[model samples]
Target: MKIEYADRMRTVGEMGAWEPWLEFFVEGIRTQAAEAVAQTNDL
Candidate 1:
């Protein structure tokens, strides 16, 4: 069972129409993404 990153990203894009769900999802994504980027950048 293997899925490509593009497919997963497209699935996430399809979910954007649901605002309530998108809020929580985006919140978590921002926090995690910031942490990941900060770790890499030594910020």
Candidate 2:
């Protein structure tokens, strides 16, 4: 997903914006993954 996003950003000449967006994107994914694991543990 990060690779795909980087490719798109590069194509659009927005490479500089990648870092901030990636930080936010990764945090969201991590939070969701943690929640999913917790739910599975509960089951």
Candidate 3:
């Protein structure tokens, strides 16, 4: 079971398999941008 699970775990260089990673990065950028905008508007 352990080896099978390890085989399923994906690396970033794989095409299409990196979608989740990209989504995470985009979400992080969006969250930071929103926080910055809110801070500026409050001032």
Q: Using TM-score, give the best candidate's number.
A: 3
TM-score to native of every candidate shown: 0.47, 0.62, 0.63
Candidate 1 is scored at a TM of 0.47
lDDT of 2 at 28: 74
Write the residue-wise lDDT of candidate 2 on 1-43 in tens digits.
6786667567557546666666767887999999999999999
> Count of backbone clashes for each model?
0, 0, 0
lDDT (CA) per prediction: 0.64, 0.75, 0.65
Better of 1 and 2 by TM-score: 2
Candidate 1 vs candidate 2: the lDDT winner is: 2
RMSD of 2: 4.2
lDDT of 3 by residue, 6-39 (tens): 3434445555456666666677689999999999
Off by over 4 Å in 2: 1-15
**Per-residue alpha-carbon lDDT of candidate 1 for residues 1-43, written as tens digits (9 for 90 to 100):** 1244345456678864455445656777899999999899995
lDDT score of model 3? 0.65
Best by lDDT: 2
lDDT, candidate 3, at 31: 90
Which pairs in model 2 have colliding backbones? none
**Residue 11 in candidate 3, Cα distance off native in Å:** 3.5
Model 3 segments more than 4 A misplaced? 1-10, 13-16
